[model samples]
Structures are given as C-alpha cells and as structure tokens.
Target: MTSPTPQAPVRRPTAADGFVVVDKPQGWTSHDVVGRLRRLAGTRKVGHAGTLDPMATGVLVLGIGKATRLLTYVVGADKDYDATVRLGVATTTDDAEGQVLSVAGPGAVEGVDRPALDAAVADLTGDIQQVPTSVSAIKVDGKRAYALARAGESVELRARPVTVSRFEVLAVRQVTATVADGGPDVPVVDIDVRVTVSSGTYVRALARDLGAALGTGGHLTALRRTRVGGYDLAGARTLDELEKQADADGTLATLPMAEAARATFPVRELDEDEVRALGYGQWVAPSGRPEVVAAISPSGELVALLEDTRRRGDDLARPVLVLAAH
Candidate 1:
C-alpha cells in the first residue's frame, strides 16, 4: 500500500496571520501601532502599508502573519487625503511641526482672488514633478533625511514625478497674523482641500508649492489620510477600540486576506487541475484576459496570484504569490 502523503509541518503563528485596518490616532507613529499589535496578537510579524506622520491621522493598513505578503501589493496603491493649508507662513519642515522659516506681514495675501487660487491649484493637477519635504523618510547617503535634518545638516532632495489626479479646494478662510519680524501687515488665508494622488506624492509639498505659486508662502496645518486603495478609515477601528476588544474577547479583529484582496483586485477562479499546476509553481494556459494580478482560487479557497506570461509562443499564467496548495 502507498504511504499516505506526508503532511507539511504547521508553522508557528508569528503575528503575521491576516490584516488589520486601524484608524491610527494622531501623535502615534506607525511603529508604535506595530509594537502594540505585537503584544496583543502575540506575534512579532506585524507590518504596515504606508507610513503616516505622527501629526496625521487616518486609516493605517497593517499585516500580520501570512498577510504580510499582501503588503507588497497594498503599499503601491493610490492614496487619498484631506488637508488644510495655511498661507502667509512658511515652515522649515513644511508642516506645523517645524520652526517658522519666514513670515509675511498682514495684507501680503489680501488681494489674492479665488480665480487666482483656482488657477494655481489647476496648475498642480495632473502629472507634475514634486520636491518632497526635507524632513521626509527619504534616505540620504544611507541615512534617513529626517535624521540628517535633526542633526543640523543641510538636506537637499531631488524632485520626483507624481500625479495629482484631483486637487479640489473645498473652502477658504482668511486670517490676519502678526509677523515675527514686527512687520505692520500680515494677511493669510487658510485653504481646505481634498486631494487624490498617486503613491509617493507629498501633500506637504503641495502646500509649499502652492504657496510659492501664490507668492505668499504656505505650510500644511493639518493633514489626514482617508483612503489607501480599497482600505478606508470608514472601515477602520481605532487602536483603543482594538485594545478594548482584545481585553473583552481575547481576539483581535482582522480582515481576512481573501476579502482584502478582493477589495483591492479582480478575482479569477481556478479549477482543480489549475490549482494542482499552480501548486508546483507551474503555469497554466492564459484565458486571454488582461489583469496584472488575478486572485486564483480552487474549491472556493484562495490559491495564488496569477499573471499572464508568454512562453514558447503559448500564453501562460503563472503564480506571483501562492497562498495554498491544491
């Protein structure tokens, strides 16, 4: 009699099981949430999608256990934010955290008209090159730019291409301010805007660039992320709620990988034979469909992420990330 197929040893849970969409609180770093989850989930494999600065608050995507594999796909997705940009004052870091670099007196921006603001915002729409804030996470000579800046070093970063598909000014408010230089006149306008942009686009940079365009200088006063891909703050729970839930039930709420994937990508089911072929990393004949990644399944269970590949003049589909065997 043939011996039964040996079973693969079950791997220990390493806190990398599934994903959790947390409504991150302001003043907490992404790493802080990871540390809290590490203790709560009882595993050390927690990871997050995009990093939200301590001053910003909103949906923060996190991965646990095998779900960590999903982060690679999540991080590149488009992001959305609602922000408040204050004019008349420019800061060193481009946000409220930095020291005031320059201040214009009252009436500096008094005559600025709505049409001018609209045109300036329009110029920022669509594809454009943006210079990131000096205090960003970008690396400079193997050191984080923020770290270098903290050490009193001069930081200069190059511009990168980013797309701002939507930049709509929702409201505007004017405020008079006293300049640190004791200037007689200082008039500022606070513009509230909602933006939808490609990944890596900096909203702080937008405020700075917009100020430069208006010739009055501007800095971001408040920033909040509303969405990343299909994940949104609407479906996210605050860390405090998560902690309370864990205390009450001994389990943390998590979005299953399949559900999260479906929210982010198109689904493509596979039959038993196809699942078997994918188990060994083999390619199946393509269905002539055009999707970068398809959620392949067998018997109603997620199996892998498949993409079309051309081999020997035959269109074949191969696995990019395999989740389970046949």
Candidate 2:
C-alpha cells in the first residue's frame, strides 16, 4: 500500500491596515464601536477619528492596524449632520437621552413661525462662542465632565469659538410627543436641520441655543452624522455587514492608506532618492506649500505624510508620520 500525501493547511485572512467607515447605530458609543471593530478586524489597534454620542448614529470613521496613526489628521475634519431639534422641552444632557428638565407653555412652540425660526438659526450660524453640553467628554481638573455631571457635580465649561458654516432648516413639524420615559405628552416643534460645522462644534448646543433664542426650551431629539471631511455615508458599512464579511473571510475590507491620504491631503510624488531618504528618517527638499501633504513613492505607496517644516533660511520637508516600513 502507498502512503497518502499530506495536504497543505489553509490560510485564513488577517487584519487589514487601513480605514473603515462604519454607519454607527444608535445606543452604541464611539468606544463601543471601536471595541466591536477590534474584534471584527482581528486587531486591537483600532481607533476612531471622532466621538459620537450614544444616542446619535451615522458616519463613524475607524482606522485599523498601522492606519491608526492617520486618525489624528482625520479628527480635525469638518462634519455634517442631520438632526431633529425639539422645541418646547429641554433636557439635562441637551439630548433625548437626558432627563426632562423643563417644558414650554401651551402654544409656545406653535407661536414660532418660519421667519422667526430662520432668524434664530441664522443667529447660531457663523463664528460664535458655544458652551459644550454639560454631559460631555471634556476633561475638567483630570475628570471627565460627564462623570462629574452624572455624579451630581456641577460642571462649568468655558465657552469656545466654533464655526457653523451651514444651518439649513430641512423640515418643520408640530407634534405631541413624550420627551422622556413615563413623561406627559407635550406639544413641541420638531425642526429637522442639516448643519455643517467645524470640528469640535457641538450640535446639541446648537439645538439648545436655537431654543433659547426662540423662547422655547429645546433639546436634540435625534441626530445623525452624514459626512466627515471628504468621507461620507456613501462609503460606510453597517456592523452587520462587516461581521458577515469577517466571518466568511476572517478579515474586513478597508480603504487603502494611500487612497485615504490622497482623498484628504494634497499629493506629492517622491523620486527614488527622496523615498530612500524618507525611509532613513532624513528630511528632503520642501514641497513649497506650507500645508501637509501625502507623499507617495514611485510604486504608489504612501511613504509618509509630510509638512513644510523649513524656517526662513533652512529648507526641509519634515515627515509628520511615516506610513511605510523601513
């Protein structure tokens, strides 16, 4: 009898090194999403670009493996949101997840007309100082603001400048609804808005300010992020889809590092010598522009993210982050 030949072992897929845009579901905190992705990507190196409230949903950009280093750049990108601001009621957290703090008088919400609402929203637009929501992740004296707020401690946060580039009212509806569990039905004006704001601008605060301007207590009823910088929901995938893909393939797909960088920053192609210099941690000739750029090698790999770090007489293209292995 002849001996049977041994078979080669099948290789399972591993973690990909790039970005993954997740369509975050409501009730999952940004950290929760990160934890879930850590499992799906089969790597604990996952990180998110921005924090999203647990009650809010939509575009949440996550980076896996070596791509985690790129998240710092993405964190400062502008964001777009679609939200429903409920007038005639206010909450402790400035959103539906908080306890009901106050309710407006009868007919208060109905009294707000289109012109008045538009004027109120306009006041919130442009450069303005805003106090972040009390229940926020902001650190105060080494403690998170939300932790103190939840512990019955008063948190006084300083007002910071933020820009609201677009505050468009998409729809307005008057309805009777409960803003909290086991709460009395209240008449409220729900204004659906699409807002584009600079990074760090709080949409919850916008709703609160808008309500205060209209003489009706207000809070965010619902919020969904639609875009983050050049990335949008168009490229986002649900967690369910990711799980199935990971289960079948043992890995999830991701936006390539070079492609993501090109979509975000100006491209600067490097020659063989320059690429070699970057690999050796040496500065190269400046790219003339002061802004950061994605430096690509001849073979189309993202060699490094460079910035013009030269002073008056000195010339150098400094590597902000080197993406390629040496």
Candidate 3:
C-alpha cells in the first residue's frame, strides 16, 4: 500500500482594507477587540483610533489593513457619550470597578438638586482644567500611572485643559446603593448625562469633578460611548456579527479606506501631475486650507494626507502619509 499524501492547510481570504466601527461590549479592552479582529480579518494590521476602558461599552472605531494608517487623523475627532455619574461615593479608580474610597452622608447628596447640578454642569462645560483619574493610562516618569496606582504607589496626575462642548443632564435619581462589598445601603444621587467632548477629554474625570463641585464625592458607574467622530453606534457591528460574516464569506464588511478618509477629512482633488508627485514623495500646490486635507487621485482614490508647508518662500502641500501608490 502506498502512503497517502498530506493536504496543505487551508487559508481564508483576507478581509478588505477599510475601517470597522465595532460596538464594543463591556469588560472588553480595546486591545482585546483588536486581537479578535486580527483573527477575523486574517491580518495583523489592525489598530484603533482611541482606547476605551474595559468597563466601557460603545462605538470603537477600528482600522484594518491599509486603513490603519488613517487612525492617526481619526483619533483627533470629538466623541460623544452617555454616562451615569454617581454622586455620594468615591472610588479608587473613579468608576464602579474600583474599591469604595468614601461614601457621602445623606445630607451631602440632598444639597445637590437640579439647579445646583445644572450650575455644576455649566461650570464643567466649555474649556476647563481637569485632573484625570489616577488609575489611567497616562505615564508617570516612563511608567503607566495605573501600574503605579495598582502597585500601591501614590499617583497624582496634573490637571490638563479639556473642552466639554455639551454636558447635559438627562435625568437625576435618588436611590439607596451599596457602597461596600457587603450589602449595606446608602443614599446616593445618580445623574445621567449626555456629553460631547474634545478628543482628549475624559468623561470619568468630568463625573468626578461634578461630584466635587456639588460637595459630594462622585464616580462613574456607567459609560457608553455613542459616537467617535463620523462613526456612530448606528453603523457599528458586534463581534458576533463580524464573526458570522467572516464565517459565512471568509471576510468581514468594512468601509473602504477612500470612503473613510473622505468622510473624516477635508478633500483635495489632485490632478495627474499632483498624484504622481505625491506618489514619488514630492510636494504639490497648497490646498489653502490650514488643516490636514485628504489628497484624492482623479479616480477617487485616497492618495495621501497633505499638509501645507512653506519651503523656499512658497507655500506647498506635502504628503504626511502617502496611502496609494501611483
């Protein structure tokens, strides 16, 4: 009897080069989603625009394949969230995942009514200095702040400027809540808010600040990011949905790189010569817009991200990132 020949391993088709807005589930870190996407896309070239806390759930913009190059620009876009700020209990991590630090007495929360809450929200709105939660990704002397905090080291982060464009209180409720591991109840006020903030703003910090302004310590109990720049929950797909698509057709649906760039940036339609110039690492005429512009080829392909630069007394646009080769 002749020995049977072994068959080669089957390879799945790679996913298209584009962006995917994932409806990130709670308790999954942004990196966790990327790890899963790498398998689904059959490519390791996956990146995310911003990091979402493991406890947070909502719109997480992911870039796959060539679209990963565009996430640098996407990270600067504003974000929106619906969050619940619990006033009366302070936590070590400034969220429900942390240990209870302090619980406010009943009298403290009762003083924070609608008008007072509104005033506090207004104070936090617009441009303000905010101290981020100690347990954050911020680096302290080349070490992550959260790592230091977890190691029982004191982490005092400096306040930074952040813009809270919209901070509307949707509802307020007074209820008894458990503040400790054991089931002892305390009176607390929970304020639901819809917040639109600049790229670097931290909603958990906002929750903490609101409580401090109201004379009650506070922490974030719930956080759901509804939007990240042009990407929103309406267009997001769950991990299971993506897996189903991949399993059915060996690929996941994604917004093409050109479409993603056009939607997120100012466009500069390039002529043949300009397209050739960018592809060859040369400069072209300035688009006159100060912001980064999406340089598009005549065939509607995204060529590069162009920025105006003055060289030899003439203003010209240079390729910050060349996406498509001519």
TM-score quality measure for candidate 2: 0.93
The residue-by-residue lDDT of candidate 3 on 264-284, one tens digit each, is 998989899998989998999
Candidate number achieving the greatest TM-score relative to the actual structure: 3
In model 3, where do residues sit more than 4 Å from their true spots?
A: 1-11
- lDDT score for residue 189 of model 2: 92
Each candidate: how many clashes? 12, 0, 0
Residue 213 local lDDT, model 1 = 91
Which lDDT tens digits does candidate 2 get at residues 1-326? 98999987543355778999999999999999998898777778899999999999999999988989988889999999999999999899999888888899877888999999999999999999999999988999999999999999999999999999999999999889876679678789999999999999999999999999999989998999999998999999999998888778767888989988887789999999999899888789999897899999989899998988766679889988887866
For model 1, state the Cα shift of residue 159 in Å.
Answer: 1.3
Residues 1-326 of candidate 1 have per-residue lDDT tens digits of 99999998543334336789998888999999999887777788889999999999998999987888889788989999999999888998888888888876566687678999999999999999998999999999999999999899999999999999999999999976654557565678999999999989999999999998988889998999999999998889888888787777667767877787787777887788888888888888775667756555655666788878788888888788888865
**Least accurate 10 contiguous residues by lDDT in model 2:** 7-16
TM-score of each: 0.90, 0.93, 0.95
| Candidate 3 local Cα displacement, residue 189, angstroms | 0.8
Give lDDT per model, in order: 0.85, 0.91, 0.91
User: Candidates ranked by lDDT, best first?
Assistant: 3, 2, 1
Model 3 C-alpha RMSD to native = 2.4
Q: Which ten residues in a row have the lowest lDDT in candidate 3?
A: 7-16
